[model samples]
Target: MKQFLIFVKKECLHIWRDRRTLVILIGMPIVQIILYGFALTNEVKNSRIAVFDQSKDDATRLITDRIAASRYFNLEKNLNSYKQIGESFREGIVRMVVVFPINFQDDLLHTNHAQIQLIADASDPNTANTLANYASAIVNDYQNALNNDQKLPYNIDVQLRMLYNPELKGAYNFVPGVMALVLMLICAMMTSISIVKEKEMGTMEVILVSPLKPFRIVLAKTVPYLLVSLLNIISILLLSVYALDVPIKGSIFLLMAESTLFTITSLSLGILISNFSRTQQSAMFTSMMSLFLPTLLFSGFLFPIENMPKALQIISNIVPAKWYYIIVKAVMIKGLGITAIWKETLILMGMTLLLLGISIRNFKIRLA
Candidate 1:
């Protein structure tokens, strides 16, 4: 017990003493959370749009005024001709253009129907869709106001209720993802580098010849990192909840438990990497290349897996972070119980066991 405590203390000191490791462990999560929460967002605000109104009537002007007053759009140009619409889009000066035909008011007043053309730049499909929805909503509001005193033969109204994320804040999606990413980076990358650093410095030889068993040595090396990872989890949760207003609708205990499971899985992978890498540089490179990119891209963090190509979807299934991401969204956003995410949880558990078994075998062989 005394030797184990001493070993753990020694490992903690080593971590605390390294400036680069300390910054990455403590600073990286905070920076990533703030950047992703504030900077990267799907919500559109003050998008530039052009208007082409051939009618020059009250109805067209009223609709244009409503669109310009709304926070989602800014009427930057009033194009005179239809040809100017394409020019505005080609110049990249406008995201959308609203065109009202010459008989817009006459058609609306006499025939009770009119056409309003909305042309959006589909270069960024998500932004284009959002712009179209906003414009359609404005037009619908205008139509409802015009017919408030008259009754139509048939009317259909659709009520939209956004669940969990009512405001559609991107932080709600990114917080849990950042948690998964940070935990994996700290546990897998840092641990592998630490072990490889020991081997490079000849400390592994000294530790191997000591009274401690090999597994005990590995445990001591990992215990400090486990505690550090737990601290990071707490920090990320506090920042996400208090700073970003991201809610934890489900069991906090379950969230922490799953996070710990993923941490252990990442640590096992780190152990496996350390067994193969003799230098810290090689270990760090391997962890970054193998863990970081997959967690960012294939885990449905930045893009939805359902929208990805079939081959990439198949490739993403093998990523551990992909399963962890699903578990987190279920627990944190959907407020689901274990039954809802049992499949993902089981997959992570299986991966952890497989990685741990392989790492143990490799470490034993290295000792032999």
Candidate 2:
């Protein structure tokens, strides 16, 4: 126990002295949350919209007024012809071009319908769709205003339930991903490289030759990383809950326990990588390209799994971060119980076991 304490103290001292680790561990999350939370928002607001009102009627004017009044769109330029639309888009002047056909008011009065051309830039498909929806909603509201007294056939209304994220807050999604990524980087990557560095620097060899057992050495190395990762978890949680106003409807105790479990899994993964790579650089690179990249890309962070190609969806299944993301989202956002996330919990545990097993086997073989 005393020896373990001494080893842990040494690890802490090393981490404290390393400015690079401190910057990455502490600095990365701050930058990610502030920049990403504000920048990559799902809320569609102040999008540029170009109006080409050919009808020039009161109804067209009213519709334009409605769009301009809504905070979702900013009224930009009044385009004269379709030819200018391409140029406007090239200049990044507008996200959408709304063109009212020549007889928009007449068509609506007689046929109870009118054609309004909407040309949207699909570069950012989600934003483009949101802009189109804003226009459609404005038109629908205008139609309702014109025919408020008229009785409709069948009333079809859409009841939207954003299962995990009801409010569709971008932070809800980004927070967990950031947590996972930060832990993986700070926990797995740092520990793996640090262990490999010890090996290369002859410290690990000296330790192995000493009375301390290999398992004890491994435990000492991993325990510090586990603590560091948990600290990061706390930082992320506090930022998400108090700073960002994201909720933690589930038990804080449960969230911490699962996070510790996840950290253990990541620590084991770091140990496994350290065993494989002969150098710290290789371990760091492997952890990033092989671990972090997949976690960020395939863990439903940037894109939804449902929308991904079938082959990619199958690939995503193997990613431990995806399973952990589901678990964290369930526990934190959805406020689900243990039963709800037990499968995910079991999968993460199983992955930890598998990685540790492979690492131990490889480590023993190397010794032999």
Candidate 3:
């Protein structure tokens, strides 16, 4: 019995000595809980919306004030014309727009009926639907308050206009998100594991003695995976269009170019991971923990980023997948041109260069 107890103590000491194992056991759970607790919410709050109050009467003022006062919405802009609404959506300035028609209160008072137009950016159908519903409920509440148990009920019709995706197809949102998630995971995981496998098999030292520089070695190792990732990009685009019925509304060439850029960025990250990881298992585990969860959470694929806490939103800006996801959505779903997504494209390019530089530097140190 004493011998068995001593063996158990030795095993415990072994586990305690391995910092990576300790982190996976204790630190991962804490991080996962925090991310899930804050980011896994379905309730959309503080959604930015615009108002086009043409009526400018007492009733219109009251209803607009109520909407602006609600916890769910933050009135961001007061649009001047109908043209500004589309510009706001394309620029990502607002999610939903409330337009009170001309003589709105006059119609309500004289005919006991009025209409309020709700125009929403429906590239994300779920958020669009939720915002429209919330606005409609608020309008109904105003109607009831105005009626105040009168024999005749006042009616306010909420005319919902879903731009970009009139049918509210789920594929519009799902395809872009899946594109970002797949490319990020596949490129990062495969490249990391492939490079780490060489180190584990003791072949990397042999290769290091050859004439190729560290940068060339890193480039040669990653090129094949880059090609494989491009093939994946093509397959995903075909499937999204044919099977899922999601159209590539923008320039296919631009989309492919952007995808290639993001793939390179992900590969750079994988090479950096390989520098720190000694085995294929460690490479893979690090890829999943670092790439998978961040792609899902910070990429705005699963949840609305605008609804997250200020701290999480700031953290999300550092995630490369977040910008890629936004680019895909803008180009694929909304059919916006390069002009609309230039900032995001620049950001991805900067990340790729930065990560590639660091990974190559690490490779040189390892080779030495």
- 292, model 1: CA deviation in Å? 1.6
Model 3 lDDT tens row, 132-199: 99999999888777878354446455578998878665566766777787778767887788678777
Model 3: residues with Cα > 4 Å off, grouped in runs:
1-155, 364-368
Q: Which stretches of candidate 2 lie over 4 Å from their true place?
A: 106-112, 123-126, 161-164, 307-312, 364-368
- lDDT (10s digit) by residue, model 1, range 1-368: 89888899999999889878788788888898898888887679899999999998999999999999999999899999988988999999999999999989999999988999999999999899999999999998888788784646695656899999998889988987898898888888888988888877777888887788776787788888898888888888898889989888999999999999999998988998999888888998999999999999999998999999999999998899999899989999889999999999999999999998888777742443
Off by over 4 Å in 1: 149-151, 308-314, 364-368
Per-candidate local distance difference test: 0.89, 0.84, 0.81
RMSD of 1: 2.4
Per-candidate TM-scores read 0.91, 0.91, 0.60
Winning model by lDDT? 1
Clashes of each: 0, 0, 0
Write the number of the candidate with greater TM-score, choosing between 2 and 3. 2
* Candidates in order: C-alpha RMSD to true structure: 2.4, 2.5, 15.6
C-alpha lDDT of candidate 2 relative to the true structure: 0.84
Model 1's lDDT to the true fold? Answer: 0.89
Residue pairs whose backbone atoms clash in candidate 1: none
